[model samples]
Target: MNQYLLNGKLTAKPGHQEALAAILFQASKLVATAKGCRLYVIGKDKADSHSVYVTEIWDSKEDHDNSLKVEGVRELITQAMPLLDGPPAKGQELEIIGGTEI
Candidate 1:
């Protein structure tokens, strides 16, 4: 089966980039042992000080969906909501074909 990949960006309110990055860092830790989790990486947008990007790879689309139910995830989402600049953009979903192993 093809792997599921998601590339998303979250824009934090002014002066909250660090705060938002912290939340996403927490999420990465929480999902480290979750079933089907492959990669959960966080990055900063070079030109956008307020933007944080997340790249995730999972065994399947279902695995990614089920990640939301993992313990502590919902709470983290709630915490992050107030730090956001506005509604988030929909993440880009991709099907993995091949890639260099990290």
Candidate 2:
């Protein structure tokens, strides 16, 4: 099986983790039904109360890229941009070496 993983970090304004998390959670609802999306998770940084992370697993990179073109997802991205301290940082793209689901 082929898999694509993306990790993104969003630094929210001070005391805005809850608001940022809410948007992320709402985005997750849309991602949950996205084609080829395997896993879409949002988590808070353990040490930083104003940071949030999004972890996504997809069947392919193309599927993941296509997701961005989705109207709802695009809207969510727009909504999330202002809440972030800066541009969302992109992490390394990882190949799934192994996982319980596989």
Best-matching candidate per lDDT: 1
lDDT at position 18, candidate 2: 91
The CA lDDT at 34 in model 2 is 82
Off by over 4 Å in 1: none
With a 3 Å backbone cut-off (N, CA, C), the pairs that clash in candidate 1 are none
Residue 89 in candidate 2 has what lDDT? 79
Error of 2 at 24 (Å): 0.7
- lDDT (tens digit, per residue) of candidate 1 on 1-102: 989999999999999999999999999999988999999999997889999999999999999999999999999999999999999899999999998753
* lDDT (0 to 1) per candidate: 0.95, 0.85
Model 1, global lDDT: 0.95
lDDT of 2: 0.85
lDDT of 1 at 59: 93
lDDT, residue 61, candidate 2: 90
